[model samples]
Target: MNQLPKESIIKLQSHINKEVVIQFQGGRQVKGTLLSFDNQLNLVLDEVRELPSQRILGLVICRGALINSFAIDGMVEIENPYI
Candidate 1:
């Protein structure tokens, strides 16, 4: 079984229980509180809501393959190792 890199795990761990915005393929997006995630980047989120419309979705398990990107609800400055 391939394991996730330590840095990735640490980054995700910091976001647990925090509000996040997940953008999916085809431009769909949602906001929710991150509950859990796996090596594949698949996520379990609570209090999920669709973006723009703000429709309540309650809870969701999102497949990593469909995910385009993830953003914390607020500004987060990631250190740039090369800079």
Candidate 2:
């Protein structure tokens, strides 16, 4: 993978107080808070957001869960909660 530009990294870090959609290996997708991320690319999420009515996931964790995705989550919209 090519290195992301510093500007993009800064932008992502600044947008921490947001929700993100994560897709797992089995075509499951979920939405939740982006609590934290480590240098190794692991994510700690919390208070999972309301998911799409059309999609159903096998599991959900409110406090937080570790997620490993192929890429950083896209722009998310959160109505409540401060990052």
What TM-score would candidate 2 get against the native?
0.46
lDDT (tens digit, per residue) of candidate 2 on 1-83: 99964432423465465667766655555676666655544555565543466443433442213443423457455587764
lDDT of 1 by residue, 22-82 (tens): 9999999999999999988899999999998999999999999899889986547689999
- Which prediction has the highest lDDT against the true structure? 1
Off by over 4 Å in 2: 1-11, 49-83
Measured by C-alpha RMSD in angstroms, how accurate is candidate 2? 10.8
What's the distance in Å from true for residue 23, model 1?
0.4
lDDT of 1: 0.90
Tell me the deviation in Å of residue 9 in model 2: 6.6
lDDT of 2 at 50: 37
- Each prediction's whole-model lDDT (CA): 0.90, 0.52
